[model samples]
Target: MLLITCPECGARPETEFVCGGETHITRPGPFAEVPADVWAGYLFHQANPRGKLRERWRHQAGCGLWFNLVRDTVTHEITSVYRMGDPKPEIA
Candidate 1:
C-alpha cells in the first residue's frame, strides 16, 4: 500500500486516506446556461491518464483534511502533496 504524507499529519498508511478522484476538474458553467451534454460530461467524465496525474485525496481516518497529490498512475509513486488551494507544482 502507499504511504501518503499529509500536510498536517506525518506519513500515514494509504488505508487511512481515501482517494477523491482526479483533481483540477473545471465546472462546466452556470447551471442555467450549460447544455445538458456539457453538464453530464463534467459530472461523469474523468481523465484516467496512464502517466503522472493530479488527484484529490482525503485523510479520512486521521486529521480529515483534503489535499492534492501528484502521483504516477503506472508506478504509484507520489511526487508531491499540497493543500487544496495551492497551485500545482511543476514535477519534471
Candidate 2:
C-alpha cells in the first residue's frame, strides 16, 4: 500500500487521506464576466501528466489538515510533502 505523510500528523496510511486533485489552479474570474467556455475549462480541465505531479491531499482520518505533495504517477513515489500555503518544492 502507498504511504502518505501528513504534515501535521506524520506518516499515515494512504486511506487516511483523500487526493484533492492538481494544485495551484486559479478561479477564472467574476462569474458573469467570464465566458462560459473559459469557466467550463477551468472547472473541467485537469492535467494528467505521466511523470511527477503536484497535488493536494486532505488527512481526513488524522489531523484533518490539507497539504500538498509532489509524487510520481508512474511509480507512486512521493517526493515531498508540505503544508498547503507553502510554496511547492523544487524536486530533482
Candidate 3:
C-alpha cells in the first residue's frame, strides 16, 4: 500500500487522497480564440512520466485541502508534498 503525505495532516494511506490530475493547465480566457487542438490538448494530453511527477491531489478524508504531490509512478514513492500557494522545495 502507498502512503501519501498530507500537507496538513501528516502521512496517511493513499486511500485518503483523491487524484486531481495535472497541475499546470490554464483555462481559456474570455474573448480568447483558442484552436480546437489547443483545447483538446489541455483536456486530454498528459505526461505519463516514469520517475517523479508533479500532480494535484486533494486530501479527501483528512484536511480537505488541495495540494501538490511530487511522487514516483514506478516505485509508488512520494518525494514531497506541499500546498498550492507554497513554493515546492527540492526533493531529497
Candidate 4:
C-alpha cells in the first residue's frame, strides 16, 4: 500500500488523500483568447513519463490541504512532499 504523508496531518495512509494528477501544469492565458486546439491540449494532455513525475494531491480525510510530491512512477516511491506554494523538494 502507498503511504502518503500529508504535510499538515503528518504521516497517513494513501487512502486519506486524493490525487489531482500531474503538478506544475500551467493553464494557458485567458480562456476567451486561447485557441480551441491549445485549450483542448491544456485540459486533457499530461506528461506520462515512466520515471520521476510531479503530482498534486489533497489531504481529503485530514487537513484538506493541497500539496505536491515528486514520485517515481515505476517504483511507486515518493521522493519528496511539500506544501503547495513552497518550492518543490529536491531528491538527493
Predicted model with the maximum lDDT: 1
Q: What is the C-alpha RMSD of each candidate to the true structure, in Å?
A: 1.1, 1.1, 2.1, 1.4
Give candidate 1's TM-score.
Answer: 0.92
* lDDT score for candidate 2 against the true structure: 0.90
lDDT at position 39, candidate 1: 85
The numbered model that scores best in TM-score is 2
Cα TM-score per model: 0.92, 0.93, 0.84, 0.93
Per-residue lDDT, model 4, residue 33, is: 93
Comparison by lDDT, 3 against 4, better one: 4
Model 4 Cα lDDT, one tens digit per residue, 17-87: 99999998889998889999999898888889998999999999888999999989999999899888888
Pairs in steric clash, model 4 = none
Residues 14-58, candidate 1: write the lDDT tens digits.
Answer: 999999998988887778999999988887888888888999999
User: Between prediction 1 and prediction 2, which has the larger lDDT?
Assistant: 1
Note the Cα lDDT for every prediction shown.
0.92, 0.90, 0.81, 0.89
Which stretches of candidate 3 lie above 4 Å from their native place? Answer: 89-92
Error of 3 at 49 (Å): 1.3
Query: Which of 2 and 3 is ahead in lDDT?
Result: 2
Give the alpha carbon lDDT tens digit for every residue of 1-92 in model 2: 99999987888989999999999898877887999989878888888899899999999998899899999999999999888789888856
* Top-down TM-score ranking: 2, 4, 1, 3
Candidate 2, backbone clash total: 0
Give stretches of model 2 more than 4 Å off. none
